[model samples]
Target: MTHIDDEPGTVSEPPRGGRGRRTALIAVAVVVVAAVAVVGALGLGGGGDEGPGAPPRAGSLVPVTRATLTERTEVDGQLGYGAEIPLPVKATGTVTWLPEAGTRAKRGDTLLRVDDRPVVLLYGSLPMYRDLGLTARAPGGAGDAPSGGGTGTGDGGTAAGGGTGAGAAGAAEGAAAPGARTADGGTGKAAAANPSASPAPTGAGTTAATALKGMDVLQFETNLAALGYTGFTVDEEFTARTADAVKRWQKSLGVPETGTVGIGDVIYSAGKVRIGRPGVRLGQAVGENALTYTGTARKVVVNASAAGASWAVRGTAVRVRLPDGTSVKGEVASVGRQATAPEGGSGEDGAGEGAATLPVTVTIRDQKSVGRLESGPVTVEYVGREVKDVLTVPVAALVALAEGGHGLETADGGFVAVKTGLFADGRVEVSGSAVRAGLKVRIPE
Candidate 1:
């Protein structure tokens, strides 16, 4: 259960979370085991359905008072690379050369060289599937990149890069775009062996190949545009410009300048990734598990309970407390709706049992906060909303009336109808004409 701290008004009382509060009357302290069924009732005020002031119950009397209320929840989280992602193999070919483990590549650099072709990296969330490039006979005047955005085609020369294109959040906009370099720093783009000549992929296909649909095609266009290839609009379908772009890309890459893209020609990823150990040695058959890469920057993930998920909302402000007692600022990057096992396999509610939680990803805005810390356990504190200077009474003081309303027992034993409001520190906000400072009300223990 999460604990709430109180801030009293005028009346002196120890704040539940430290920073006590003051109230005009007796320091009001209330603790309710059950959550208030209606929170909006606190905002509502009008004539009560019940008749004049009356005290019907012969119970203990508690005075109405004012105070500030806040709720705080603390949860455990781990600090480290946001998440580990596996770079899947998109092209079918023997691994010619793989970057040594720990070798980090920039966003647009080559992470893998398959059959001497470059598999470039970009920063984006969408995954590449189909082969990307232009067709020999495109519908629109023999040229253009995808419609969304892309670098247009160049004259069968060098595949240009750094072209401007619309960017998607979380998507890798690699600096090189596509077909810029191979593992050996060679352009797989062999300058058209003969000026006005086309190059080839030793034993593979070229841009003259047909383009496949899906996110894969779209990303390729985005990659090409980012690489400075413009002239065609970035879109999903292959166009003459895309083919021209492909030929130029191939030409610049030192490969056969075919105006088509093949599956084995290029690979797309989110961004340049530090190479992990190769799954297969050079010249080995490619497998499903290609390689894994982690985010260059560090981040933290919190497995929060469903009830506590509101604090972990996307973009919510967060304060991370590191093991060294240092504090850092961050924001919720993403929240997972899927439920997974809690810390203890059960939950924070009790002994390890049937407990599940929501996975929340938090990104550290300031890299300096992490300093030299690599990874470790950390604490996260969420500061929820605060209700201030409101008429408050002990939760026990509220009684559900039979006439479709809630009320408080007056000093004369008559019931004064009232509405409930923000609940905090076992105290609740109550509003009604019958409510006032020092007005005593009956409460059941």
Candidate 2:
């Protein structure tokens, strides 16, 4: 029986400088040996009870099967609370208390205490940059009133106070400063023109005041209402009713009922947070970088190659291999828009040196599925490509045809030309009129 170990093809060597006659003889001998080897490999030179189209006697046969093919890429990742974000304390005070690292804090919870006063955490996108309070309103329209009123409804459906639209009233009041009432009940046209800056003095001899307003006001109001402070409609305007609720909330916190929210009184985050270490020590002056924080949920961060980040699209389903040899379902939460090279021009083992990488964040489907792992190295598998219910055969079963492309040898010694598709594992996707599941194919040993 003849076995085909090497491929059945001609082997050529580069020309050598020597005697012309000897070189020619050696070349002829090499060609003869190559031809004999090809004949044996093709099962034509062996004496066997096989037909001309039969594969070598020692070749193995495998049946073609249908299966789902997926191309996956695994990359090293870190399991932790995503990324640490710096939380700078904008308020001027000495740090009286700080939460221990890895402690979780949620909305309406005191993250830390400054000067014995608690700095609460709220949910919002905008940061608290100014004080929020209800500005004094003029009794009636006198002179050119700012034309703004509190549209916020009190315990009843009635408007909170001054007759003005909800959106416009809060904005106008926010533009003016506390105590400085405008002729038009705190809604100054000048304030509306520039809400960020304090309202300018008008010819009516009224001093313009600055009160906190805008979406930030609305965000705080939303949080306040969520915390069970009722009797005030949640709106952008901080009306008298809103101030009353604020006082109640302050009383609950054991703080003075100032009826106003001062800057640094509350910090805004998206949702729940896991507290990091405090930059300042106890009784130390709180600088801008007083503390750090991160999302409470567990996540895996992967620094994927920028060139191969196409599979890191947000919402893409993935699998995370844990250190315990277990895997959990996950999905891509975010992909960095910019690619950055590793610092010092060299990357870690996962990322090659000098390669630009895009940060990819993956969130586990079930928070409790991760067990007790807080932070460690992990492996994330991303599916790069997928093909379902396709006929496939061992890659070794493919035979290179002299013309071009590939063919498969059937059990009956018939050759079926096939078109190759996705290659995964040790199998190659095959399609042809004659290729079907359960069809046996020959693979040379």
Candidate 3:
């Protein structure tokens, strides 16, 4: 994936090593971009080269507009629970039972039956790989997510709130922070992000009364609080009050009050999740890749270019189209951190290498408008780049300069040199001492 350089306003020259006529290639690419911009601004029927017409008749001349020029675009999207959540198995056992598809499982609920033992679900974005038993190592890690493993929601709903579990000392693990808002409308900053940042596993299976130190103890402490067992400072140090709280939580679950959390006792996740189809059948041998499922949340997801990502900030309004031809308002809820390489086909027919893309998620504002359609293809329109109060002209109006760059040919016999900035809809952002909103320019037929 290519990183956008933070370099300020540095001009980038085109690739110099290619064998083709670079100037012609660049000119062709520029024409295409200008055509798109003009088509968007003028609301033309479609885009293609319109052959040049005779010298500008009064009717053929178009005046530049002084209002805002916004690039509103409609892109295809998938309407479903944003992305699929994988339930990485930390336990090894034969599958005894699997939940029916479309079942909804909350935290602490039974997600599956392995060897007749229930695989309980825990809410948090982090995955579980080790048992939650008493140990000397802490549990926080520098990772992110709360896709609610072992579950899938088709409605495209997200795990609500901004939250994070802090790892005890350097012993934190299962850190999943997608930087989402917490339920209290607060950011989930108590997060344990460094998965490998935890203390080394040592002194396993200490007595319940032992004053333990590590992230596992810390997570065990936090899970107890989330489960409503309070009265202790949630930390890596296992004090007497912490033990009392754990024992009470165990008792509530109808298990022995051991005052110790087993690896299988509790689960972690970003929050509650809707489960999808199970990955295994009954009696299947459990391997490294055991549990997997889709999600049930209803969100419109788009794979947008870096240009589109520029407008992916939270709270941007979007128009979504369902399968029924119904249109509903949506909002940009989240944007991914890093850009990812285009997946698959890199050949002539595929998303070529070198260029990267950003993933954007939009949530439907009027939920009732969507009705029962949970998963399917949809379209969304985003309000893109806006150039305000500037002189603009149809891309077809541009006349290549013999001296280099581009210029605007006046209706009569003169040409004006202009500096261009943004390109949107079919209009190019142009400014010059002489250019105004009402100036006339020639257009190709």
Candidate 4:
């Protein structure tokens, strides 16, 4: 093994390796044996005539070194799709078909078949909440708008009877009430009689042509447009052109070409999904939860102890030690807020019961870094502490002084009191007035 010597009064070991920790321990044992032999010779008068200020010889000696010290902690983690989310069904029908477990589906792909119609997948954050169709602008007419909301036709054109009907109604109201205004811009006698009354909006006869509008509409139109259909603007309003595009999409899926899309016609997710086992059987009525899915990418998850979870912050860089003795770089993707107790038995900390843990998600930076491994237990390593440009020695070098402090013994049998800083990887930082580079320190046998 290589030795580091920067401080005169200490000996330090290098950082421990993933697989070489056992080997490092064995080497320490060998060094102890050799030191004992050297001390035995010194005790047998190998060094004669000790000076007044010099102490008796100890074990073998090693020089101290100034180097960067880092402490690392390793935790157990499992590699797989981060988490599975249940896919709820909103359509009312019999479940005719379901994809096999582990099947992958992307945008516009069929996720499940209900009543012999496909429930397609789409990439979006909004859920479908209403049927995307036209609404008539006529007052109390056959319209799709709900109560207390904007109403219009999907064709972006004026409503029928908007001219003559509105003029007749205005004329009748102006005659009945002296202050009301007619269809024309001039105010009627009713307005002079009641100056405080607010005039009815002039454009009430002609409503702005619009359709069902919401972020969901925009998401649907975007996905529909992306699937090669055209003529509809991708926006929050689903207009006549959007309904026509939906019909074309429905035709391709062999579904009814009704110019409306029901809430159950599509499912939205973040991106491509890998299907889990179906929760309901074929021919059964669709229930609240029909199946499950997860993102296509693999990730590492750790059930870290809540008490020691400071390192589990999101975006923190980490190293994953694979079973094959190799390592890959990753970062914390998420950290769960809720804590849960272990199911049974001891946990990683050897706590027998009632140990709570929070879930942590780690994302590998490179997709192919883990090689062919799909899902398995792995080790995640995090740096616990670090100190740079400090004089360090093996933890075995320091000795307790009778004066209520710590000191290191030099090769000349002189003792130098020192202050300790950080202890990491079997080495420690030490400093004192007399301690300097190349000062040899004794290891206790």
Candidate 5:
């Protein structure tokens, strides 16, 4: 056996056992060195070559695009019907009326029958009486006689009793007597005693004495006449004639010709109607002085105020972000004419008072788009000016520093300050000597 020493200067061989132990120790040292190298690489990998400190890596990015921008204003309002009318009970009778509620009536169609007996007596008596009295006082009591009765005078020139002195006296007495017999053997006593005896006059037809008036009524009447029911004549004043007209108008308009206009009844020109404020029901009592209808044009209006108002204007296009994450394009229809006081107070949070604003009407440029939007809280975005074909970067790519500026991280772990322009759609336009398209940037992972 040859004896070997492990020392370098000695050409000696070690025992097999020692050789195996040395091999095992070498393997352990190699593993320890590799682990140390890996830990060092992880800690120092983010250091940029440009400077001792740099922005962290960015995790995401977005692209820039060129598009047309439209300015817009935003407002809130409700959907409403164009027209409405209220029908009231004009005659004061139980609703046993004609032209059932909600039924269509035509011109001259019967609407409702009131206990017109009262009104007839109230209006008809005097005229009938006057005419009857005139007939009773006529000469020879001829008018007083029934229409078919013959005259009392004979063909002889001398009156049957006029030649006798007693006859003349008797005739004079007869005419003056409060109660006396007539030549026809019929009693003229009643007519002679009461010269003014006559039956009271009465009204005819199923019309109301009181009807609605004002522009609303006229508009309704005009519309009714146009519908081919011409029985009604428009007289600005609400009268029996007007009531009759309304009934006719209602029938033509496809509503119950109840002689009374009620809320929700379509009156006036077609498509130019109104919605009642309080609403109208069948059999509901209405009167000339009552508020029976509202025009379609009347509606609640809303406007923006504070910074929002200043940022928006009429005719400017805006996007309304609904709760569902969908968006609708709308134009600023108007600004308030007057600034209202803040809802609570003038504190920092208080809405300021009397902020004058102007009203703007936003015509629905696209009805389909507007239909998706509901009347409620929504986010509005007004498009500003646009920049085209410029160098840009994702907003996330830029790191905000303690200093007043921002810096971008380079692929090799270097940082550079960048000049930024308009920011939009998650990207910002940037200008810098070292910045270029397609350059890799580091952001926080």
Candidate 6:
């Protein structure tokens, strides 16, 4: 101590063994303190303020609900009757004897009268000759000819010269001279004897003397019934009784009482009669009027544009939305057998004033309801397949997570990843570990 030099702010090193022991003791004390602190926190039940095993704070959330879903398709259409017909002029002539615009006719009753022109004789002599010549040239033509007769026999017995005799001789001569007559007055007597023979009728009973009877009259009566008239019977023959009934109906309706219902009358009664050209006028030739009358319009038909027709189907349920927003339900009754574009216009082009559309018929199942809005515009809808019992969540409850995904706050103040499913009526279905039945969730404010 007497020889030690005093150095400023300097100290000498201690013994190595003693220094190591002191450091170890300090490390042990620090470890024991940390363990005690951990044990205290766990025993405190993981309370807030850095307690061990405590869950993180989370936003509010909602649990997903399960529901059934149905897929639907929408369309547009109109309400109409199941049957319709277009009355056309039965025979071409000047219009005559039109009772009224909306007259009703019984079956077999005269609907309209055409100017009774003499029966038109369509001379087929040249055509017959040509046909005969062609047949003669055919390989089997000669074989078909009767024996003991030449080409004249097959020429309807019209030959230049031939004998006139009874039985076989007359037959042979007739076969030879189809154009030529035989002597002995046999052909003349035959013609005189057959004076009662007449030409067969043609062209759908549209003749001057064509009286209505049988099926034609039945159709007429059927059409009348469809128009809501029920007084007369369809006997397929026009009778005074039918005409009387028609006249009575016409009078009741305050129309002309001519006792005859024309095509115009039928169409008008059915509610689809147009009033332009070919209308019934006074002094028009009865049965000779050029006015074309279609059949009675029993069913209402609306034509759809090509694009609309493409999506339509037979018997597809349709809803008619009215201009006033009221709606009625029905089904597609029929589609046109053929497609017609607007005359002189392309399909892609907009329809012009004169453009025609493909016809479609929508049948009303509930006539009483449809009758309330007849001839009105409408919109239609169709329903498709259904989906059942799927997990769904409210569209508003999802939160964006940090990993570019969605998450839901768990009841235990934790976060969970969920998978989503079908979306309908503003709700989305979801699935995930965090998603469970009756699980309370925290949603972000």
Best by TM-score: 4
Report the C-alpha lDDT of model 2 over 197-249, residue by residue, as the tens digit: 55333222233333446898899999999999978878778777888899999
1 against 2, candidate with superior TM-score:
2
Q: Which residue runs does candidate 5 get wrong by more than 4 Å?
A: 1-274, 279-302, 306-308, 346-375, 384-390, 400-404, 410-414, 434-444
Residue-by-residue lDDT tens digits, candidate 6, 1-445 = 2312122211122346655653453344333433423432442211212313333232445565567643444444544333333334444455444445344344324444445321111111111110000011232132223222221332244432232222233334334433444464443223322336431221111212223455545655555555456666655666666676666666665666776654333312332232223345645643433333332322335666655465467877666655677556767667787767665676454455434467777666655665455455565544443457876554444445434445444444334556655444444456775455666555444
Per-candidate clashes, comma-separated: 77, 7, 68, 13, 47, 50
- Per-residue lDDT tens digits for candidate 5, residues 1-445, read 3232332222122446666654453344333433422432332212112223342333443333233222233345433322345533233432322332233333233433333211110111111111000011222231122321211222211112332222333333333443345585444223222325441121111122233445555554554565554565664444556566656654544555666554323212223222234332335543432223333232223444444455456676665555566665657665666555445455233344534333333334455654534244455555545666777664456554323355554544334556776554444567766566675655423
In candidate 3, what are the lDDT values of residues 14-131, reduced to their tens digit? 3675334535534543455355435444644122122253323422677776755666667788898765566765556788877776676776677776666666676654455454
lDDT of 5 at 98: 31
User: What TM-score would every model get versus the actual structure?
Assistant: 0.50, 0.64, 0.50, 0.65, 0.39, 0.38
lDDT of 2 at 138: 44
Candidate that beats the other on lDDT, 1 or 4, i.e. the better one? 4
Q: After superposition, how far is residue 74 of candidate 1 from its true place, in Å?
A: 2.8
User: Tens-digit lDDT track for model 4 on 1-445?
Assistant: 3334334543333456533643454354445534433432343221222323333234778888897776677889999986678875688899999999889999999999999989999998877777777765765334322221221122221122232333434433334433334464334433322336554433233444458888888888889889999897899898989989988998999988987888888889989999987889999999777889998888999989888999898899998989898989999999999877788845555477746799999999797888878789999988777789999876667665544466676664445678988766556688887777777777766
- Model 4 ranges with Cα > 4 A deviation: 1-66, 137-210, 343-354, 393-420, 425-427, 435-445
Candidate 4 to truth, TM: 0.65
